[model samples]
Each structure stands twice: as C-alpha cells, then as structure tokens.
Target: MKSGTVSQDYDKNETDGKVGLKRRLGFFDSLSFLVGTIIGAGIFVSPKGVLEYSQLNIGVALCIWAACGVICILCTLCYAELGSSLPFAGGEYYHVRRGLGPIPAFITIWTLTLFIRPSSNAARALTFAEYVSRPFYSGCPPPELLKKSLAIGILLTLGVINSKSIKLATWVQNIFTILKMMALTLIIVYGFIEFATNPDASKPFQDAFNSQFPNAAQTAEAFFQGLYAYGGWNFLNYMAEEIKNPSKNIPRSVITAMCAVIVFYLLVNISYLTVLTPRELISSAAVSVTWADRMIPSWAWIIPVSVAISIFGSLNGGMFMLGRLNYAGSKEGHLPSLISMLHVRHLTPAPAMIISTLIACIFVIPSDLVSLTNYFSFSSWLLVGLTCVSLIVLRFREPNLERPYKVFLPLAFVVVGVSAFLVLAPIIQSPKVQYFYALLFMFSSIIIYIPFVHFKLKIPYFNKITCYLQLLLEVSPTDMFEDSKTE
Candidate 1:
C-alpha cells in the first residue's frame, strides 16, 4: 500500500520533495473511538420508545433491532472499504466529495458542521444533564434554564477534553468505552441470573411475525424507531485518517466495531426483555434503570451513572469527529482555513472543537430533552440513506479503485439501502417530525452553501459530476469523462 502522498500543490510549494504522514492511531485506539462514539443514552432511552411501538412481543423487538443492526453492518463495510482506499479525515464528507461532486460534498460537510453534529452533541449532552439531575429532581424536575445550563456545561467540558490532546482525549475515550461495556455486561449478566432464578417472574416473549401483527404501516414506523437505536454503527468512518494504518486498519476497525456493537445491542435488548415484561418496559421511560434496580438492591443509581458516562463519551466523540470534518474542510480551502487551525502547541483542532460545542449549546437551548434526541435520530437516518445511495452510485462510476473492505454482497447492500429509503416514507407519513427537521436543516445548508462558494471561496467546478459522485463513494475517478453523463 502507498504509505504517504502529498497534494500536488503542496509538493510544488516545497523546495525539496518531501511528504509527511500524520501520526498513527493503533487498532485498539480506533476501536475505542468507535465504542465511545456509540453506546450512548440512545440505547437507554430508545429502547423504551421501541417497546412502546413493539409492545408485548419482546423477542420480536429484539429481532427487529438485530435486523436493523445487520443492515448497518452492511453499510459500515461499504464505508470501511471507502475510507481505507481514500483514508481521509472528514469521514462521509470525504467519501461524498470523491464520489459525488464538490457542491454536494460541500453541502454534506456544511450540514454536518452547522446542524447534524451540533444536534447530535446537543442531544447527548441534554441526555447527560437529565440523568445527572434525576437523582435530585426525582419524578419532579428543574426549571428549563437550569437544564440548559447543565447541558452547556457538559458540552464545554467535553470540548475541553477534545481540545487538550488527541492522545489524552482518546485515552479517556478508551477508559469510558471499557467501563460502559462492562456496565452493559453487568446489566446483561444480572438480568439473565434473575431470569434463571425466578422463571415465573419474567413475562413471555412477543412473537413479531404473528398473523395479528400490526398493519404494514404501523410495523414500518416501529421498525423505523428500532432503526434509531442502531444509528451510530458508522462512527468509525469519521476517524479514518487517525487510524494507524488506513489501508488495512480502517476497514477492520469499521467492520469489527459495527459487528461488535450489533451483537452487544442484541444481547442487551434480550437481557432487558428477559428481566422486565414487554408491558412494563413499554410503560416505563427509565426501563433499563428500573430493571437494574430490580436485579440488585441499591443499584438503580448504577444504571444512571453508567448511562451518564456513556452519554458523556458519546458527546465528546461526536465533537471529536465533527471537529475533524470541519478541520479537514478548512485545510482543503472549502471553508475558512482559520476553522482548521490546530493548537500549535497541542496539535488539536481547538477552534473547530469550540465551534462545534457552541453550536451544540445553541441547539440544546430551544429544544426540550426528548425532542433533541429524536431530532438527531431523525436527521441522522435521513442523511444515512442519502449517504448509502451515494455509495452504490460511486461503485458503477469508479469500478477499478482499490477497496480494502468491499461490501460482501453488493446487490444486497443496494437492496438493504433501498428498503431503508422506502421505509422513511412511511415513517414520515405517519408523523412528520423528522421530515420537517430534515428539510429545514438541509435547505438551510444549501442556502449557506451557495454563498460560501460564490463569495467566500473560489471553488473549482462546484457542481461537477466527479464531485457529486465522490459524495457517495470516497474515491474520485481519475478520468472525468470515463462514465456516461447523466445530466
């Protein structure tokens, strides 16, 4: 594999021919980054929402979650291959740029920096604030300002961690990831033990495939909700440039982390159901904590503390990844290079980190706790569908590019992606929350993109075909006219 190559312009500027590679992140460090990005408050809160839709058939709910996970794994593999071959810092922004075109790619990065990443960070921080205050507030809660203040604090703290040092930030991430996993394992083991000791205590599992199954429309919405719980399976794609060996390590980390999360999610969901009846889980908002309380005495706080830690890690993870995306954009001259400024002493993207944290703080202010999470989930899935389509399009246009981790069944990947896209129609038709958010943020992004290109940056071929294709796949075609033109 080619170890390093500088941009042609950079090489031209150098007096002597010399290209430098960024510092390497080991396999375990990459895995830790993935784990930290995922395993957040969504797992704790989203399950209750899924149970609300999938009531009485716990096994079926678990199965649906597992199915969503499988589809995510397929997409993760596709991204892994793209990331490995191209090995850039910006994650989807890089892939989309290489596969789609500059304009669309710019839009993706713009949306991520301005909206999606901020929304994600805000949601996680808000979740942390809610849990942190729960013990004091009990069933009754605090004033709105207090909650927002706490959320902002959470964002700032995580931003500080990210800006300090990548090594320090990732080390903290690895520790939290391990702790969160252990906490989950404890939940699983304790629940199973309770089930074994008192079989009569558990409720019967639900059968999702029964004839009395909810109508296709209702089932589709439930599946969509289930999909949110498995949303962060692509976290590894964002940190491709940081990995020690992009060609091989990036692919392995993405696939391995996704697969592991899927299994962990499945097992945890099953354990949750085994301990609590579907009816109980559906009704209880804090189902996981309640389950923990029942399994062990004086341990209700354990679940809350653990979940808070997990969410904290997730908040930092999103900021870290999004910081890189913005940093990469600045480096490429697509965005103000000032945003790309690294702390000369620390070598971290402090400006982007602070900016991301600030936006996140803003998002958390107007929104209540629950809407923030749902909004992030809604926007995340819609964009994920867009990104997946970009993947398939890039393949046909750039067939010969090296792929370190290709999706095993290309047609199956396409089918799964298409099915995911189709499912969104029903989800939006039933309740138009995510659709509204998707349109609002995306249109706003386009508005910003037009000016950023026309005025701020003299971007070359902003609407070129190669740029659009790169938006889907990470690799741009060497020859522009190789593929038949669509437009």
Candidate 2:
C-alpha cells in the first residue's frame, strides 16, 4: 500500500490562520547551519580514535579521512534530490516515510529522539565544558559536578537562543562558522610553513603506509570516527522548508559546505603531523590543543577558547534542526501533537526544543557519552543506509514527481553500499557486545510502535493535557511550511 504525508497539504495550510516558520534563511544561513553542525568538537578534541585505529599509519589515516568526506558528499547528493523534490522539514524521517512507509519512519525517529540526537548533543556540550573548565584546573581534571553543570548550561543557552529568535540564531551561527574556518585556516597555514622548514615533518609521511595493518574491524571503527568528524552534512536538508528557494539553496549550501570542510580537514590533519609525531598525535587527549602548544606555546590558551565557541555554534544548529524533526513527526501524527506547535509570537518550535533540551540534560550526566558515539554508530549507519535506499525507491515510485535538482542515480547506490559496509563490517569481522545491544534496542522500539502508533491507541485526557501545556508554553499548533517547490 502507498503511504502519504501531510507535507502535501502544506500549501493549503499556509493560507490558514495558524502561524508557521518563516523563510528568513537564505543561502548563507543554510550554509552556516551545515558547517556549524559539522565543524564541532570532533575535530578539536577527538580524531585520535581515527589515528589510533588506523594503526598509526599516516597514509591510511589520511585516506580514511578523504574517503569519509567523499562518502558524505555522495550521501548529500541523494539528500539534494530529495530536498529539491520534497522540500520538507524532518529530513530523513520525511524522506523515509514518503518512500518506505510510516512504520519505518516512526521507528527511525523514535531511536533518534530517544537516544541518538540527545546523546550526541550532550557529548558536544560536555566537550565544550571540558575546554572551558581546563583553565580553572590546570594540572588535574575538573570536578564531575562542574563539568556536568557546564554541559547542562550549554544545552539551556542554545535551546533558549533557538527558541528566542531565528534571526539571532542565524546571526550567531554565521559568526561562529567564519571563526571556525579562520581557526582551521590559521592552523593550515602554520602547518604548511612548519612542514616546509622543519625536516622532521617529512618523517611521518616517509613510511606512512608501512605502519602495522589494522584488522577489518579496526578499519571500520576508524572510518566511523572519521565520519563522526564529518557529521551534519545533511543538516541543511532538515530545514528545507525554512530555507529560501530551497531547490537552489539546498544544493548550493550542501556542496559549498562539503568542499570547504573537506579541504580544511585534510590540511588540518596534515598540520597535526608536522608538529606531533604519529605516537604523540594518537596519545594526546585534545588534538588541536597539543598542536597549538607545539606551534605557539605562548598562545596555547586560544585554541581551547576558539574550540568552545565552535562547539557553541554546533550545539545551536543541532537543536535548531531537532525541533523541526519533532515538529514534522508530530504533524504526521507519529508524536504528540504538542511537539508540532510553534510559539505564538516567535513562530518557533519552542516546545519541541525545550523537550529535547530536557532530554539532553539527562544525557549530560554520563561522562562516557563520547565513547558511546562509536557504539551508536552501528544504528546510525543502518538508518542512513535505509534512507539511501529510500532515495532509489522514490526515484522509481515517483518518476513523475518534479525534481529541480536530480543527481546521478548511481551516486545513491554508492552511499547505500558504503553505509552497508559501515554497518556490517564490524559485526562480520569483530563483533562487539555493543553491536548486539544496539540491534536489540533498535528492534525493541517496535514495542512502543505497536501499542501507540500502529494501533492508533489514544491516551485518556491527552487532549486536555495538550491544551493545558499549549497555554502554559504560549504556543499554538502551526502549519509546517510553504510549498517551496520550484520548477
């Protein structure tokens, strides 16, 4: 049976009395959102997992980095076609629901809302706190209480900014993105100078490929680490409904962000090599901080400060899009109707962001949230592969659908293949208990789906509760978006 989405009714609802999100975001705004989300603490504090799992092989590690970028670009191509055609909020959820069915969509979003996004955001917020708290405790680690408090503060700050004003969020995102680029560019320039003048810089590259070989499982883990650093390539697609001229801007923003990030990442990795040897690079807790100490010991404090600002932008972008995901899901009746609401005056999805923030606050207490990113990658790639499959399914099912930006059909298949490898290689080569746990948790969602979503069971007095909460939150049920379809 074919399934339909409320996105088709967006045009009709736009003229109704309900308030909706505005098309205030342009090409640069969209671009900043993607870059801001992608260039977070992963690059600054982490990346050691990538180097370590690659068996300290500089050549293989660099190849894995480049390969991750290429894989994301392919994924972006599939998203570009969907964004240009569907032009809806919810991104992967909407695309999956449209091409596959509602059951799959609900399960996908259930996992993301319940675990994936909140956990990832919490990890980034904690990374920010680590940098911020480092100065106070010079020799030893910061107190657990202090770190957790600061992480929760970050969540609240960004959540309020997003709920307050779209203009303010966009302004902050652009400024931080430019700052991130400048910071990385400065490292790149300095690294090239060091590599040119210092004879030791060439040592790592001399036998880059001759290092010990990593097993298939190790390689797969390394790839996930690199891809983690390149996460958020599809963030712009999440707000297609909010972007101006989305058919044109989605492609422009995604492509530009990818090229800029890919070049910066490759150069930044090379720069790290110039100062720190392979062992030092892998041993350091924070990659950028160590690089700064080696290159500019007097100003070593600046890198951590800039990295905190970079993560601030990244957290804001993630929260901004997460609200839309909940809103889109609610509009489709998969989630509570309250999540679909917008602020009466601001017209922002404040209720959704607030709820997501509260969930993130819970996740902030767990100190090991960053390591769990690897375990969660199992489900993340599984769903991503499913989303790519949706692209191919939609192509055949809706051949007549207007597609202002059609990518080469083969590109979608490449993403599907890569996603499959990422998901399966670990289990096949060196299965971990986490993989088993991840699979168990993913299927367990079916329990919730069957009772509430599939059977259409209603909670008693849910309507009254929704109404009371709506009034308390000062929000109203609003239409999703204007049909941004461009011929």
Which candidate ranks first by lDDT, i.e. highest? 2
Per-residue lDDT of model 2, residues 1-487, tens digit only: 1123323444343456658776678998999899999999888878788899999989999999999999899899889989877877889988888888887888889888878888888888887898899899989999889999999998998899988888898999999989988888888999999989989888888888999988877888898889989988878877887887777888888999999899889999989988888899888989999999989999888899889989988988988888888878887778898998999988888888888898888888766655665677767777888888989998898777778789999888888888888878767777788878777777788888888887879999998999999999999887544342211
Q: Please state the error at residue 476 of candidate 2 in Å.
A: 1.3
What would the C-alpha RMSD of candidate 2 be, to one decimal place? 3.3
For residues 84-203, write the lDDT of model 1, one tens digit per residue: 666657777766666676676777776778776787778777778888887888779866677789999988888888877788888888898998998889987876786788756464
Task: Give the lDDT of residue 159 in candidate 2.
Answer: 90
Cα error, candidate 1, residue 311 (Å): 0.6
List where candidate 1 sits over 4 angstroms from the true fold.
Answer: 1-21, 201-203, 206-211, 368-379, 409-416, 419-423, 426-428, 431-437, 455-487
Write down the lDDT of every candidate, Cα atoms only: 0.68, 0.84
What residue pairs are clashing in model 2? none
Q: Which model scores highest in TM-score?
A: 2
Candidate 1: global Cα-lDDT?
Answer: 0.68
Please report, as a residue range, the 10-residue window in candidate 1 with the lowest summed lDDT. Answer: 476-485
